[model samples]
Target: MLTIKSVSKSFDNLSVLDTIDLHVKKEEFVSIIGPSGCGKSTLLEIVTGLIAPSNGEIYFNEENVTGTTNKLGYMPQKDVLFPWRTVLENVIIPQEIMGIRKKDAEKKARQLVEKFGLSGFEEYYPSALSGGMKQRANFLRTVLTDKRLLALDEPFGKLDALTKREMLKWLTTVRMETKQSFLLITHDIDEAIFLSDRIYVMSSRPGRIVKEVHVKEKHPRSNGFLLSKSFSELKNELLSSLGV
Candidate 1:
């Protein structure tokens, strides 16, 4: 559903990404993991067209994507919810920006909130929700953009370990139920393995795809899969690739 070719970026001779090439097929989940400053977030910005690549091209669904499109949704590392807006209001912001009528947007947002397990909290403020709940609200808002493809930048980065695990399971359920495609940026190798169909390990600084590991697990994967022999093998392989 998306393709990036020979993408690179630099600022005043400091390279961030270098000749990066990757793709995500329809309804497929992909993750990129690497050490800090490896340009994972930079690559995501390029894909989202929030920033331009210094060189190379990006394509979405066979067409060259030069700028942001309504077909792809994004959630950055932070929830970035508006403290003043209630959960429902925050969710409908994208639709509002797209010029959908307030009533119609609210209806859609309400449905998404219920589907994403935040039904009762629709009236809650961002500050009142737990870290996991905030991210769920953020995910609902992102998906409510009517986009089938989502690019998430460490959506679970701020959660505690236990909450992160719960969120991962929640995300898995949502993906199975929605069949939406995702490209995620994460520093957690285990999270990547648990969520992605394919994993891209990047090199440092002038980031490049150092290796690609295919996670052969089926969808609706359980936390039990994390303890299996293959999971450990894959995790170790990824660590080795990242030079950790």
Candidate 2:
């Protein structure tokens, strides 16, 4: 549903991305992994129109969208929740900003919280929720905007290992129900493999696509899939491609 062609970006003569070309099909979950400073997030920002690329084109569903538009939902590294707002309020913030009617927006938000496993905590403040719950609320808020594509930047980066794994499982279940396409930037290799349809391995800085590995696994993937031989093979291949 998305296409990026010959895209490049630079800041004050320092190039961050170099002629990157990528295509993401509808309902496809793609994860991008690379070493630090490799412009993984920069490339995502370019796609989301948060940053303008120095060259090339970005298209969504056949329309060229080189700059920011409301068709995409983004969850950045930080949760950026309003401290004073309750979980339900935070989840409805996007709808409020988009001029959606309060009652309708809130109803939709309630559905999201319930569907995503945040049912009873809706009235609680962000400070009262754990890191994983906060991230779940942040995700709900992003998707509530009714965007076609979700661009996630390390949504589970800050959680403890156990919580991160639990969130990944929850995310997989949510994806099965929602069928939303996502472009995720993650540092966790196993997490990427577990959740993504395809993994894009990027070069170190001045980033370019080094390799793309297809996971070849079906959805509703189990924890057993991670321990299977195919999973280890693909994971090792990605590591080798990255020279890790």
- Per-model TM values vs. the true structure: 0.97, 0.98
Global lDDT scores for all candidate models? 0.91, 0.91
CA displacement after TM-score superposition, residue 220 of candidate 1 (Å): 0.4
Over the stretch 1-244, how does candidate 1's per-residue lDDT look in tens digits?
9999999999888999999999999899999999999999999999999888999999999999955656599999977899999999988988999999999998877767766879899898998999888999899888887788999999999899999999999999999888999999999999999999999999999999999999999989998999999999999999999887
lDDT of 2 by residue, 76-193 (tens): 9987889998898888988899899889888888767777889899889988999999999999988887887899999999999999988889899998888899999999999999
Clashing pairs in 1: none
Q: In model 2, what are the clashing residue pairs, if there are any?
A: none
Error of 2 at 45 (Å): 0.8
List candidate 1 segments past 4 Å from native: 69-71
Q: Which stretch of 10 consecutive residues in model 1 shows the poorest summed lDDT?
A: 62-71
